[model samples]
Structures are given as C-alpha cells and as structure tokens.
Target: MKNLILLLVTLLFIAGCTSNKTEFKISNNGVEAQVLQLKNHQISYTVKKDGHVIIDTSLIGIVVNEKSLGSNSKIRLSERFSEEFDYSMFGGKNTAYHKTNISKFEIKEKDGFTWFLEFLVSAEGVAYRYIVPGTGTQDVKGELSSFRFPNNTKVWYFERNNDWKLKSHAGEWLCSDISQMPAISKMGPVQGLTLTCEMPAGGYALVAEAALYNYSGMRLEAIGDNTFKANFAEGEKGFEIEGDILTPWRCILLADDLNSLVNNTLVPSLNPKPDGRLFADMSWIKPGKAAWYWWSGKFSTFEAEKRTVDNAEKLGFEYTMVDEGWERWSNKWETITELCNYAKNKNVGIFLWKHSNQLNFPENGYALMAGFLDSLKQTGAVGVKVDFMNGETKSLIDFDEALLKLAAERKLMVNFHGCQQSSGEYRTYPNEVSREGIRGVELNNMKEGPLSASHNAALPFTRYVTGHADYTPLAFTAPGETTWAHQLATLVCYYSPFQCIAENPEYLLKTQKIQPAINFINEVPSVWDETFVLPQSKIGELAILARRKGNDWYLGVLSAGEKKQLQVNCNFLKEGNYSAEIFSDDILAEPVPLEGLNPRANLTKRNTAIPFKKEVIICDKNNNLMLNIAANGGAVIWFKAREK
Candidate 1:
C-alpha cells in the first residue's frame, strides 16, 4: 500500500509541471521579449533590454463579436522568418533607409472560427496584427491589449481632445506618473496618440498604432498601476472586417534615448510599401516651402492674394497656399485660374484649402469636391489642404483613405490639417506629404503667450516622434515670450515635407535683421538626407538638431529656459574643412517694439522679426563648435563643405 501511494504522488507532480509550461522567447539586437500563453487563451509578454526587465508581463489579446480570443486559442503552425529590405524616400531622414530586420511569427488560432495572429519582431520594436483568411466578415467585439510597465516608468502625457478646435492646449507634453491614468472623455483628458515611456534602465519605449487602415485610431486608457489598455474610438462590436481582412499594426518602438526615439523609422517600416504605379512618376511630387496667407487675415481680393504670391517669389518660395476666403473674390474662378497662372509664370506653385466636412455634406458635396479637384488639376494647382477632420472614428478613417487615394489619382499632393496623427500612410501614398496633428503656430494666434518657447522645445521629442508636424512655424511673438532666433531656428528644427513659411512675404523681404537666415531658409530642403540629435539636449528645455541635405548641414538649436551654452559635435561630417554660417541672437542689438510687430515676418531677413547677429566660422578638422543661446532664444547654423 505504501508503494502504490508513492507512485500516485509522483504522477500528480508530473501533471502539475505540464500545466505550468515553459516560456517562449523572441529576441533581436540585445532586446528580448518572453511570451506565455496562459489559461483561457490569455497572452502575456514581458520585454527585456539587455536581459533587464522593462515591460513586465503585459497582457495582449482581442475579443470578437462579444467572444474573447483568449477564451480558447490553440496555436497551430507557428513559423518564423527574417528579411532585409531597403527603401528610398522623397522626403524623410536619409535618402534611403538601410536594411530592415524583420522577424515575424505567424500563428493560427483554433477555437471555432479560423484566424491568424502575426507578430513582427524587429531590432527597433514589436508589432502585431490579426488576419482573417478569405473572410466574409468578422464583428470585432473589442481588443484585449494592455501595456503593463514597471512601477518606475514615467510618461509625457498629452490630454487629447476629440474636438478639433480644442487641440491647441494639447500641445504641451506634461511628465506624469505612469500609474495615474487620466479619466476617459470624448472631450478632453485622453492620453496622447503616442505614449512615450521613460524606462528605468535609462532607455525609452513608445506605443502608437501603425498602418491604421480600415480601423478606428487607437488610444491608451490608463487603468492605473503602471498599466494601460489599448482603447479604440469604436465601441464594442463597432469594427467589422470583410473579405480577407488584415488589421492595423499595433506597435511599440523601443530605443536607448530621445535621439534614437526620434530617429527610429520602425513605424513607416511596418507599413505597406508605396506602389510606384500609384504615384506614376513621383518626380513631380516636389517637397518644398510654401508661403501661407490665412494667418495674416483673409485675402478676399485677387490683388491682396497677388501680393502674397509676389512675396513668395521674392523669397524663392516654391508655393503660395491660398487659404479660405479666396472664394469671395469677384469672378472667383477667373481670379483663381489667373492666380495659378501668375504663380506658375513666377516659378511658384499653388495649394488651395477646402473644408473636409464640406465634402461630406449630402448630395452635392462629394461630387463638388471631385469636380473641384479635377478643376484644380486643370488649373495647375499642385496640392490641396483638407481641414477640420475632427474625430478619429472609423468613418473618418475611411474617408481620409478614400480622399488620399483620390488625390493620388489626380496627381495632387495632399496635406491634412486639423486631423489625427499620421498612421504611416505616407509609406503607401507618397502624395500625402504633411499633416497638422500638433498644436502649432495657429495656437499662438488664439492666445498670444501660450505656445511658448518651452512648448516649441518639447515638440521635436514629442510630436515629431510620431511623424512630420505641420506646425506652420516661424510665427513672431512678444520679445519676452520667444526670442527672434528661436522662431528662425524652427524652420530647420521641425520636419515638415510641405513646409509652410507662416510669415507674410512682405516680412521676409523687409525684415532686414533676418535676411541672412532667410537666404539659408530659401535653400533649405524640406526633406533631409541625414539627422543627428545632440546628446546634451533635454526635453522641454533645449533641443539641438542637425540635418543634412546633400553636403550641406543645417543646425538648429533652441533654448526654452535661461541663457546657456551648448556644443555642436560635427564628428559625423566627412573628414574635411567646411564653412559655417551662424545666425544667433544679437547680444547688443537695440530692442524693437515687443508688441504689434508682425510675428509672422520672414525671419531670415535682417531686422525682419527680431534683431540677430550673423558670423562666419571656419572649421579646420575640429568638428566641435560652441555657442551661447539666450533665454527664449535659439540659433541656426549652415555648414557647407568646401570644395577640395
């Protein structure tokens, strides 16, 4: 009887061991994630950087039509593959993105309905999505994705507002406790589109949605305790898939610093490649500077609009953006057609604005929009800016996709103003060059003192991390609020493909103090060949970004705090001598009127917006350079490699 009892105990112990199961791991470039499939189909994963825990067993799964995917998922045919590919960009950091290391896992589920979950692991981060093979339709009840971080993690929270007009105050990124999730609201207090976490190990991890096609945009719900759940704008059972559907990529970008975070191309790399045929000779899709008119007030007459276009030509701007109210001119069609022709003769293009909701209005809206775009094409209008797309619902997402596809068909470049953050769509449609998702210069117009230097300093590390921001930069403000040099530096600091020079043309030519900066701005390429973020930079305090367009390097340094000195390391430059032009705050210049002076003046002009000092420096194999930036001020440096 004793021998039989011992045998029974041994069998029970074996059963317990089988139930616990061993963990599965996927890793690349010293980053690792261990995944476990728990009881009731729950999927949990913990991310490790260099074998140190960063993400602690985060829950991730989905629910379909009120049924949980975690209820009973049987993994079938698990396979892994890695591929390396390269791509060139018309407008982005570097002309070409080097090889991408894609490690993918394809798993089949088996709990009645047939579906697949594919997880892509890369050196930069992780992304996963669901695929329904040959589907009729699937009603998604909701997603069960949650991010649980270590208690020490902190975040830069952006309280989102569903209403488009309320987006201005959302620009400021406030550092906050990870455990405190803001209350959910359709109006305010929502988390940012990208929730960046400061890791305990001195690294960074960013969470955002990618390839957001046919799905509602994803937001994060802080459920407390260093935990956040993926929340879609769509309610339970709101998302439906039809005919071989693939879901959007839910991604997390991991990096060692703010620079690496800014430099990571993981989001676009995860998107579908742009079909060359869709663009049909993308050579005409020019990415350059535009002179915008709305900020200076409505140019309701052809003559008023003509002066703006003339200023654009004077400043060598490639385009003049004719905003709303242009339709009020007598003989509107003739006036616009004449303006386009005039701009073309002056070697400048035109971008027109249209209200997004107007296109959605009843019977005539869609037809009218289509017809207007066709007319614009005939009128030689190069681009269109669609504004006021207030929400991130599925319907709006669908509408945006449709509009972009149509715009591509018409061979017109597009800019989405007052819209949601970009979801890597530019990878698939090259014509969609820029979008306004941040609270930019337009906010400064509403409240004079709010979009301060600190807000500008934080933008690169925050908003620009997600994608290009149409901040409509270079607006003038009170002398005590932001220095003239800071405004001038922004044109180089911010990355916008269809960059808008927010100042009036008259200001660019008349601002005598900023002309030297203006000359550099005129030639500054909208896209970059390379980018470097200085190590000494701090979020919300200072930012120093250096970018290369061909052999020329543009350095933009901004300080939101007290005056301080910083260094620019040019070790990344080719081993050779170069001539550098420095535009910085004039320590001795007389102060001008701090009020009523147009803030949107062409800053590169001397005495244009704020008085500045310009100097020429020569580098003799010493790449290290230093400068003193004033409080609420900044600097712009142009380095050109000398001919051998």
Candidate 2:
C-alpha cells in the first residue's frame, strides 16, 4: 500500500513538470526576450535586459472567427535563423542603415492548423508579428497582444483622440507612471494610446507598430495592471487576414540613454528595403531645403509664388512648396505648368499640394490617379504634398501604398501631411521623403498660441525617435516668445529631407539682424551621418545635440528654462584642431511687430526676434566651452574639421 501511494505522488509531479515547458530566447544588443509556453498551451513572452526581467510574462495570441485560436495552441515546431544586411539612404537620420535575427515558432491549433509567431531581435530593440497560413480570408476578431510592465515602470505617450480626422496623431507628448496611467475619454476605454516606456531598471522602450501594410493602424488600450492591449480603432476590430499574411510588427524600441533612444533603428529596419530601380536616376530624390509660401498667411498671387521659387534659387534651396489655393488661379493647370518651368530654369524644384480627399477615386471621377501624377510630372514639378489624410483605416493604408507606388513610377517625390505616425514604411518607398506626424510648427500659430518651449525641447526623445517630421522649422519666429537663436537651432533639431522652412525670402535672406544665423542655415544639410545627445539634455527642459554632416558637426542647444551658463564638450570630434562658430542671442536688440504671423501666434506684444551675436572659437576634440543661454532661447555652434 505504501509503494502504490508513492507511485501516485510521483506521477502527479511528472504531469506538473510537463505543464511548465521550456521557453525559447533570442537576444541582440544586450536585450533578450523569452517566449514561453504556458500551462494552457497558449503563448506568452517575457523581456529581459542584461539578464534582468523588465517585462514579466505577457499574453500573446489572436482571436479568430469569434473564438480564441491560440487558447489551445501547442508549439509543434521551432526554428531560428540570423542574418545581417546594410543599405544607404537617400535621406534619413542615418545616411547608412544596418539590420540584423529572427526566430519563428509554429503553433498548432486544436483545429489541426498551424500559424507562425515571428520575432526579430535587433540592436536597438525587439519586434514580433503573426503570420496566419492557409488563409483565403480569416476573420480575425481580435488580438491578445499586450504589454505588461514591471513595477514602477513609466511611459511617455500622447493621449490619442478618438476622432482621428482632427490630426489625432499630432499632440504634445505626456508622461505618466504606468501604475497611474489615466483612463481618458467619455467612454473611458483608454483608447488611441501608444506606450513608450521608461523601464524601471534603466533603459527605454517604445511600443510602436511597424511595417504596417494592409493592416489596420493600432492603438493600445489600458486594461489595468500596468498593461496595455494592442487594439484597433473603433469599428476596425475585424481584421481580415487575406491569403498568407504577415501581420504588422508590434515593436519595442529599446535604448540605454537619450542618445541611443534617439538613434534607434527599430522602425525602418522592420520595413522592406527600398527598390532603387524605381527611378532611372535616384539622385533626383535628394535631400535639401525648400521655401514654403502658405505659412506667411499672406495673399500670395502667381507673382508672389514665383518669387518664393526665385528665393529658393537665391538661398540654394532645392525646392519651393506651393500650398493650397493654387488650383483657384485662372487657367490653373497651364499657370502651374508655367510656374514649374520658371522654377526649373533656376534649378529649383516645385512641390504642389492637394487635399487627400480630392485624390481619391470614383466620386471625384479622377478616374485614374495615375493621370494626375503624370500631368504633374509633365509640368516639371518634382513632388506633391498630400494633406489632410488624418485617418488610418485599412482602405486608407492601401491608398497610401498605391499612391506611393504610382508616384515612384512617375519619378515624383511625395510628402504625407496631417498623417498617421510613421511606421517606417518609407524604407519600402523612398519617394516618401517627408511626413508630418508630430504637432509641429503649425501648432505654433494655433489659437492656443505657439507650441510650448518644453514641447520643442522634448521632441527628439519622443516623436523623432520613430522618424523625421516636416516641422517646417520657422526662423521667422524670433523676437516673439522664442529667441531668434532658438528658432534657428530647429534646423538642426528637426529633420525633414524635403525640409520646408515656413518663411518668405525677406525674413530668411534680407533680414539684417537674422543674417548672422541665416548664412549657416543655408549651409546646413537636412540629413546626418551621426548624432550625439549631450549629457546636459533633459526632457521638456533642455535639448543639446551634435549632428555630423560629412566632416562638419552642428551643435544645437535649446533651453526652455532660465538664463544660465552651459558647457559644451566636443568629445564626438576627432583628435585634431577645429573651428567652432557660435551663434547666440543678442538680448538687447529691439523687438519687432508681427507680420506674416498667424493670429494663433498672438504675438501682439513681441520682442526683437532677429538679434544675434556670432563668434568663432578654436578648439579640439577635448575642449569644453560654456554658453550663456537665455530663458526661452537657444544657441548654435558649428564645428568644422580644420585638421581634415
């Protein structure tokens, strides 16, 4: 009887051990994540950094046909492969990009079907996606994709608006202790949020959707317990999985510091590589500045618009963007063609704008979108800015994809305005040179008044981490609430390959007081080979960056705080002599009245926006220089390699 009882106990122990099955792991750049098979045969994962658990086991599954397809899933087969690749960029934070390992687990459901869960371990972070096989069309009811944070984890996110048409993607970023993350909105579902976490154990992680093609844009809904579930927009829960589909990647961008976070390549790396063959001469898809007319809010005629193009020539700007209302001009088509020809003579390109709704088919009888793109190309205009596409439903994503392919064939560059947050799809379509996803300079003129000083300082650590934005950095805002030096620094702070500056020629070119910084602005390029975030930088307080272009390094320092002396270290430079040109505020120089300024700016009471002092200093890589920056002001320092 005793032997029989012992045997029964041993048998029960064996069964329990089997239920706690082994897990698979993939690691890169000091970050590791474990995929666990739970007792219920469902899939779950835990993330670790430096062998410390940052994210405890979290659920990972999908609901299909109104049922939980993964509830009874068993890992039937597992495979792992690692590879590395490199490519050059036409325009990006990095001139060259590298991507590196992927693991695949085949989960067999109770229905005798197998689907895949794929993970790509990257240097900056980890990304995972679902691949549903044998699919004619699978009614994907919902997903169990969720992120569970460790105790005391913090996150910075924009409280997303339910009405996406109101430029929902653009908003001032806010931070919260995940434990106390607010439940916002009338429905109180915590909808439209994307969590970018500041891990408790150090380092950072931004939860974002990547390579989103043919999939509905996602938002994270707070479900309590310091967790957020991946969910679709309202009425977009039914995800149609047509054919063998690779669902968009749910990515976590990890970094150890502000510099690493700003330099994370997780987003674009998940996207398919660009097909260089799209254009006969890819050089035409270059990176440079543009003269934009609409920001002035002045009644611009054909002659005024043409003068903007002429300013492009004078300023060495590669393009001149003509915003809305251009179509209302008499003989619109022919008149635009004439303007295009005029710009082409001066070696400047023209970019025309059109409301995204007008570009759609059927009702507009535009019949063929290709015809419109072709006409623009014939007129010698180099690009088009598609605006007001404020939503990201499946059909709209398809429209964006189709439009990019069409524009590529016609050799016309494209900029998506008032759009959704970038999923790094630009890697697949380089023609998409710029996009507006952040609450940029336009907000600086809203009835609410200029974007807060903190908002500008904090952007690099938040929004710009995913991709560059068409902030249209305004040099014209000096003398108002922000210093001219601060406005000038944005050229380095915000990057848009098709960099459109929100100012007419006079303010930028002929303004006497602004000339000191204008010359350097003209010389600055819109792309960078390397970037370094200085130690003094703080979120919503100060921003100091050193970005390299060829042999020169541009240092931009923006302060949202009071006047104080700050030091700069040229540690990023090589061990050799260098020339540093410093441009900072001249506080005593009189203020000017606001013109060409939107009423939202409300600078009824303003200061001298253009007064600046320029000084040159000789330095080496080891030198530390002090700068006296004013409240709501900034400075720019250019380091040229004298040794080289």
Candidate 3:
C-alpha cells in the first residue's frame, strides 16, 4: 500500500509539470477577479475549494490592407470576458483620418465585486461597456478579435457624410478609464452585453464576457460550467451589393466556452412534414403553368385579390405566389385568418409574408400574437414567405427551430428569405419549401437588370450546391427583362420545384408562347434523386448541370454574354439509346441523335458540337438533332435511358 501511494505521488508530480498553469487575484470583497496572462492563447486554472473563479480579458488586434490599391486602411480591436462587458465605437461620425486618436481601453471597479472594461473606437465615436460578475476561483472569462475578408473592400464599406471614411490600420492594446455607456435599443436596454464593429477596409469582429463564482452551495458543474451566453444588438441597415439593396440586420457572437454557446442568431426554423402531406405530395407544382405577383400591393385590396385569383385560375396556372407586404401592417390574428379563407374560397393557396421581427415577437410580444399561427392553419394557407433575418446566435437559432416545428405542427409550408447559405436544413425539415440566398431575378425589377446568364451559370456551382434556392424563374420580355428564350432556359438552369413564372396569368395566356415550358414545370417534381455539377469547359462564361427524378434525367446549360460551341456527352449514362426532348431559346424541338454513346467515349468517338448563342437542346442517340440559342440564353433537356 505504501509503494502504491508512492507511485501515485510520482504520477501527480509528472502531471503537474506537464499541465498549463493560470493564476488569478480576487478583490471587491472576494467577487472581482483578475487572471495572469499566459504565454499562448490557451489558459487553465484549478481551484482547491468551491466558490473560486477566474476572469480573462485577452484582446486580439486585426490589421486590414487593400490589395488593389496597396493601402492599409483600418485596424480592429476585440476582446472577451467571463461575464458581460460594455463596448462602443468612439468616432463613427469622423470622416477625416486621425492618426493620433484611434482607440482607447480601460478597466475599473464599479459595484460590489463587479468590474467594467470600456472600449472606444475613433471613427464611429461608439462606446461599449461590460459588467462582469466576480466568482471565487473556477469561473472563467476572456476576449478575442480577428481579421477576416481582406480580398473584398466593398462588402463592409458604407458611405458616411458623402465622403469615404476609413478606420486605423495600426493601434496598441491599453488599459485606461471606463467611461463608455451601456448599449440601448429602440425597445430598451439589454443585459449580458458585448459590442462589435466593421471597419472601412474589410471585415472585422470582437467579443467579451464576465461572471460570478464564490457563493456557498454554488456548484460550478451544476451551472453547466462549459456554456456562456452573449447578446448584441442587431444591425438596422439593409445589405447592399453592387447596386442592389436588401434589408436584414446581422450580428456575430464568439465564445471559448464551446458547449455553453449556442449560435441561434438569424437562423430559419422550417420543417418538412407540416401535419399533412409531405412536399412530394404537392402535384400542382409541375413545370407547365405558374405565376407570381408582388403580394402586398396586389392582395391588399379586395377587388385586386379577386381579380388576381380569378385571372390565375382562368389562365390555368397551377400556383400563384403572394409576395411581401401582406403581413407588414396586419398585427392582429384575425387579419390573416380572413385573408386565408378568402384565398381558399378562390381555389388558390395563400403564401403569406412574414418578417424576422414578426417571428421573434420581441420579448413579451409573443403572447399577443400567440394565435397568429393557429389562424394560418385554420385559414388553409399553403405556405408563409418569411424574410429579413440577420443574426446567427443561440436564442435566434432556437427560435428558428421552434418556428419550423410550430409551422409543421400547424400544417403550413415555409419559404425563407434574407438567409445565409443553406446548410442541409431543408433535408431535415423538408417543409422548409424554399430559401432565397442567391442574387435572383427580383434584383432586375428593383435595381439592376435581371440576373445575368453569368450569375445564373455561377449559381449551380456555388450557392445552389448547398440546397434549394427560389430563383423566381421565367419572366419573359417584361420592360427591363431578358429575352423570352433566356427566360425559358432558366426553368432548366435554375432548380426549384415550386418555381415562379414571374408574370401575370393574363399575360401568360395572351402570349400563349410559354405553354410548353409551363407544361414541363408542372410535370417536374420538387425533390430530386441526385444532382450533379458538370465540369464546365469554360469559366465564368458557361456552366452545365444534370439532375434526376425517378427514371427521367434533366440537363440544363447556361452561357453568359458570349457565343460558344459545346461537345455534349452522355458519359454519365449507360451504353443504350435514350429518347430526349429539348427546349432551347423559346423553341421546343423533338429528340435528336447522341451517337457512339458509351461510358468510355472520348473526344474522338463523341465529336458532335452543338452550336449555341444562349440556347438549349434535347436529343436522342437514334437521330441527329440541333437547336439554336439566343444571346444570354440556356437550354433544358429531358431524356429516358433504356435499361441495361
């Protein structure tokens, strides 16, 4: 037994030498704490008894430089703590570059056992204050900041006072006076707070925290010692890209307490099974006949709503979308209920509009709107169009999931707007019918011209690769629109089972030119068995995609701003004759020949070059087939391969 004790002591001595060590000092009647710095970014502490705590206040400095202009434009400072901390930018209004005054920091005692760290940035004149509760020994807190997005300057750039203002590129970390005020919102003040800023040169972010430790019977493990929460105000300005503008507030939170932190800010909550039929059961979504209208203006008046519904049914459109504006003014649950019943009586499913604020219900507001969702179910609404979400924090994430679950339970579908990239959430919650994350055709109606073929071509590779994006396809020759041929090509190039024709039902019937495309749209299913990003022979100028549902294969190719020839191949198919139907440049043609088709066919055996000037084609291997495409155009092909 003595020898065993000696061996255990030896092991303890060796472990002590290898482990990292951190030290802390307590003040303010054994509540406030200060941690000694470590050589590396990581720090560790051990308390001999209960009610001990440690506080960390490490700040990271980021320097941003413009690659195109060879200039260093801004510096961002950030930090994190154990409890909540106060933070603000000091010089947001200053347009002139001031080398002498950049940023200042300070830490001091406030109330019992509590300490305050104040951060002041020069360009924005914003001040941030943090209040950290003091614990005995085991409690932990810290701060960190980093540089991101040096390649693009315009992403975070905003115009101030008609002059281009910038942030400092170099600064030092200092401990100074704590004079910054606590953060406040239009609603009210917040607790457990942190502050962040974006400089002119590129992107930058920071975070901090504070907490308490040494009370009797305060079990650190029971408090879920691994987790912590940080809250910040959501940005109010809308996001602007190139010349287009969109409104959605966004914020980011960082933490060393990985388990304690939940990234819920700005995430959408949508589910697949909405208490009724699965998405696959929506047979009305085939490609043939669909239409869209800006829901708010069109549906606000009874006469207009009756006209839209009657006209849509008369034109034989399978579906119609009620865009934004419906939910903007109607705060009562009865408003939605009435609208839903009216739409149902007209034989059209209503797609209601909702903003992130409506979903959150703002603290105590959830109770007043508690019956809003129940009304949607009672009204027979098909789906809700949700938009303007701009954060990814834990509470928001939880809310997102809750909304999806609630919508599912109520049997209503969902379409998310103002979202980050899709993260396979739709697969889990299939009732999350669609999302808008890419630059789509709406931009053409609002600001810039319609989305270019290049933009459409780039999507299947970058954004669409993530999952479903409602691109609102096929607007034929509206005043500022692309050609009819280009519009037809999008039905195939863009992937969405619940696609929008983006034209009036009356217009569609009058033209009668879009009948074939509408037929195809109605026939296609929303979910696919497989999707492939074909290797493009060219970059930025062209892209091709192939998808399958059941036994049918669909292929789409898009070209941007240029004419080109492509050697189409069937290498992905079996060595057998397949029937194909092609749609290109407003013309629907019969199947054509794809000869010498095999798994190993090379450039020599498969030498057919399809001429394209923004066009699409569909062909079978039994006969030679060719179709012409318009400038800035695309093509869609449906084929049936014989069994091996």
Candidate 4:
C-alpha cells in the first residue's frame, strides 16, 4: 500500500511540471505568432487570459485590401531579421537602453504582428523586442512608446522633458519625447494609435507601446499576455456588443525605407514634387509675392466674395485662396470658374479649396474623375487646396498621388490639408507646394496666446526636420490673434517653400507692421540647400535654426515661456562682410545683456542692443556680432557669404 501511494505522488508531480512549461515561436511568414506546448510544436494554444480565449494565431495576420476600410485596420505579419542594434533616448534619465538575450530573436506573427519579446530592463523602463530580417540596415533604431486614448476623451499630458505639452481634441494621437501632441480627429467612434519611424540601416526591431485606457468603472487590467494583443480586439466574439467602451490598440510597421513606411501604412502612392521644376518656370505663377485667403469662414455671397478678392489684391497680396463652403452643390465647375475669373480680373490668382475625394472623384468612377480633372484645368484655377485625407491607407495615398498628378497636368499648384507630417514629398512634386501639419497660426485663432508659439518652436526639430510645413504664417491681431512680434518671427520660424500669410489683406497693408517679415519671406526661396538646428541645451525654453537659400543664409532663434540666451557662431558662413537683420521682443522694459551675437561687427559698430520686447537689428557680419533674443519671441538674421 505504501509503495503504491509513493508511485501515485511521483506521477502527479510529473504532470504538474509538464503543464507549467510554455513554448512560444514565430510562424512561417515570420509575423504570425503561435504558442505551443513545450514538448510538441504541433500542439498550439490560442491566446487567452483568465481562461477567456482572445485570438487565434491562425486567423491573426490575414491581409485584406479594401478602399472602404481605413488603413489603420489592415494587419500584415512578416518576419523581421536584423544583425545589429541601434537605440537612443532623449529627456529620460537614462539614454541608452539595450537588450541582452536579444542579440537576435524571431518576431512571431500573432494577430497583426502584435507580439512583444521581453528583453532586459533599465532604469528608464523595459525594452520590448521584435526582429525584422532583411528589411533593415546594419543597425536598427526606432521610437520606444506610443500613447492611445478613447474617442471623445480629452487630456493634458506632459513628457519627461516637459518641453512639450498635450491638449488633444477628441481623437487618437501620439507624442514622442517631450513634444506637443498633434490634434487628430476622424469620423467614427473608434480612435487609433499610429506611429511612423525610420529604422537604422540593415537592422529592425519590434515597435511597442505601453497603453492606459480610462473607462468609467472597470479597473485597468492586463487583458492579454502581450500589450499589443490585449489592446487590439482581434477575433473577439463579444467586442462589438460592448457599446461605448472604447477599444484602444497599438500598431507598428516594419519598414525598410520611406516607401515601405508608405506601403505598410497602406498608402498606395505619395505626392512627390519634381526636382528643380519650379525654379525653371515660376514666372507665370509670380514667385516671391504675398498671398491671402478666407479659410473656415463664410465667403459664399457674391458680394462678399468680390469684396474679399478685391481687398486681398489691394492689400498687396498677389493671390487669394477661397476655402471650403463654396462646393454647396457638389458641382465645383461653375463656382470655381467664376471665382478664378473674378480673381484673374483683379490680377490675383484664385486658390480654390476642395476635398481630396471630391477633387479626385474617387467614388464617381475613375473615368468620371478624369473628366473632373480636365474641367478643373479649363476653369483657370491657379491652385486647389485639398483637405481631409488623414489616413495612411493605400487608397488615400494613391488618391494623394493622383491629385498631385492631376494638378501638375493642369498646371495648378496644390496645398494639402489634414496631412500626416511631410516626408520630403515636395522634392518630387514641386506643384504640391505646401502642407498643414504643424500647430501654427490657426491655433492662435482657436486657442489663446503663446501656446501656438510653444508648439511652433517644438516643430522645427521634430516635424519640420522631415520637410516643409505650410504653417499659414503671419496673422495680425487687432484684438485677438497672435502678437505682432510672433507674426513677424513666423516667416523665419516656419520653413515652407510656399508660405501663406492668411489674414485680411487690407489689415496687413494698412497696419504694415508685418512688412519686414513679409519682405524677408518673399526674398527667401522655399527650398533650402542646407539646414541645421542650433543646440540650445534646453528643449522648449528656446530653439535656433539656420537654413541656406543660395549664397545667403537665414538664421532664426525663438524662445518659449522663458528668457534664454544662446552663443552664436559664424563658422557656418564663408568669410565675408554680410548684413544680419535681428528681430526680437522689446528689451527696454526688461534689461538683459544679449550674448553670442558677435560673429563680426562693422563700422556701424553697433554694440547697439535695442531695449524693446521686439526689435530687428541689421548688422554686417564682417565683425563678429552676438545676437541677443528675448523670451516668448525670436530673431531673424540674414547673412550673404561667398560660396565655399
């Protein structure tokens, strides 16, 4: 009896050990993920938590292509293989976060490539790992985290650096480092979390995010083994029945280049500006002229339209943009034709606004869309501002490319609104002139003072680093707009080849307070030969940028919320006597000695530091002159140097 009992105990112990062992592996495509019993690879277990089956690996990574469905929903799970690792962090206490045991690992394909590999932990946080083979360079580096929120939720969140802040408007968005969050909105109760980053050459890793969703009563709980899987309700039976409960998900794309980024996001094609085409033939469009538009407001009445166009030309603007609300009948032909003729008679080019779908005629059949493009050409419209294509899906991307092609064919300049951040598209599509991606002058009209200023400063290093942004600079406030100084500095702060100074042209011509900046903007070309972000040490407190437009180089320095000083260097300039025009806030009321202004001073030997909150100093760079800028303000300096 004793021997039999001992044998029974041993058998039970063996069974417990076998049950506790778990095995996880990558699917054949390198993206579909499967969990198997340790002893037998064929014996697979579906993703489950607390005894509830979540997703089956068999159905997780299926690829579906459709126009009606947005790009955010498509899932592709493929293997990512990398040989090296490159990682860096900013604003956090620890900068270098590397992984052990992950010198190499396989990225399992589980419902939409939403799987995480637990790697080494650091003081900063845990580093989740994924591998993308043959799709990366010698080394791989990408952003570490992304944030997701439910629809209709509003929150104020700050990053580690605190240089940027977030005030979201009823949609999903992502923030990196200590930067302000871009406001995003889409039609539908569902909100999405989207992030795009360039991987290092020849190496790739899994992109991961730690998410927190605020629901009324339920406590925050771990829904699945992997955060990516838990956040996304893939193959869940009862998810649709749960009304009003916001389901938040995380998505990461394994991309080899910018093209892959576009392709993975399901954007069919990109609008690329042709190289040096504008330089060859911009005389017809009148380059270096001021422009204005009445946007997001009433401009339908014939009398109102006539007055606005007349006022725009009279105020020294060479062009007028008639934004939305004009397409009341969905027929753009008659309205655009009339507006273009009216603006042409007034000697101002008319920029008409239309939605991308309407302009491209996506739903009306392809041939009919072609006819509409032909009509736009006949209407004599100088340009068209297409808006509301915020998706990165293939159809939307293809539509963007088609619109650019149509515009080019018709000789019409284009401005893209509600766009993802610029990705050097202007390089190929010169006619695709400007894009509204930054938090610019519009925020001043919607929100209060200086928030726009703070966000604008943060953009140069982040969004503008990618390419030109049509920030719609220079709004002169009679009572409630941007400060006069802020308006003056925007020309230098925001970098766009096609800069739109949106305001009542009459107001600008009469006040003439913003002329200096306007003149500077006109003289400067949209394309830059080279660019650099000045090192200020502090993040949001101040930012300095320098860009070259020919033999002449323009440098702009801006401060946000606080007074800061920067040391200027003239090493970037070829040795020569060049004039530097400095613009700043009134320094007289607040006395502070400006530093690093001397690259080279002249017989004008102006130690002359003007004491105004906002001031412009024109100095010759023959003698080193240090530029002193004020808080909540900026300085624009132009220097002409000999070619190296």
How do all models score by TM-score? 0.90, 0.91, 0.51, 0.55
What lDDT tens digits, residue by residue, belong to model 1 across residues 1-644?
Answer: 43234224323322232232335677778777766665544455667877767776666566655555543564543666676676776444854352433333333356466666666667777777777555577676556666777877878755434344233224456566675554434453346477778887788888887898877777776655566666666654367766765778877888887778778787777778887678768876888899877775644467877888898888888988888887677877777889999999999999988888777542443566677789878878899998887767776777788778778888899999878777778878888888887877765555423466777887787778767878887765323367777887888789888998776667667867667777886888888988888888787888888888888888888788788777778776767778999888875677555344654432222232345688998884466788877777898888888998
Name the candidate that leads on lDDT: 2
Q: Is candidate 2 or candidate 4 better by lDDT?
A: 2
Winner by lDDT between candidate 4 and candidate 3: 4
TM-score of 1: 0.90
| Model 2 steric clash pairs | 478-609, 479-608, 479-609, 591-607, 591-608
Q: What is the lDDT of residue 298 in candidate 3?
A: 41
Least accurate 10 contiguous residues by lDDT in model 1: 11-20
lDDT of 3 at 191: 18
CA-only RMSD, every prediction = 7.2, 6.5, 19.9, 14.9
For all candidates, the clash counts are 19, 5, 86, 58
lDDT of each: 0.71, 0.75, 0.39, 0.41
Q: Which tens-of-lDDT digit does each residue in 292-359 have in candidate 4?
A: 54532434544456677787666555666667666663455776688778888888777777776655
lDDT of 2 at 283: 68
TM-score of 3: 0.51
Residue 335 shift from truth in candidate 1, angstroms: 1.9
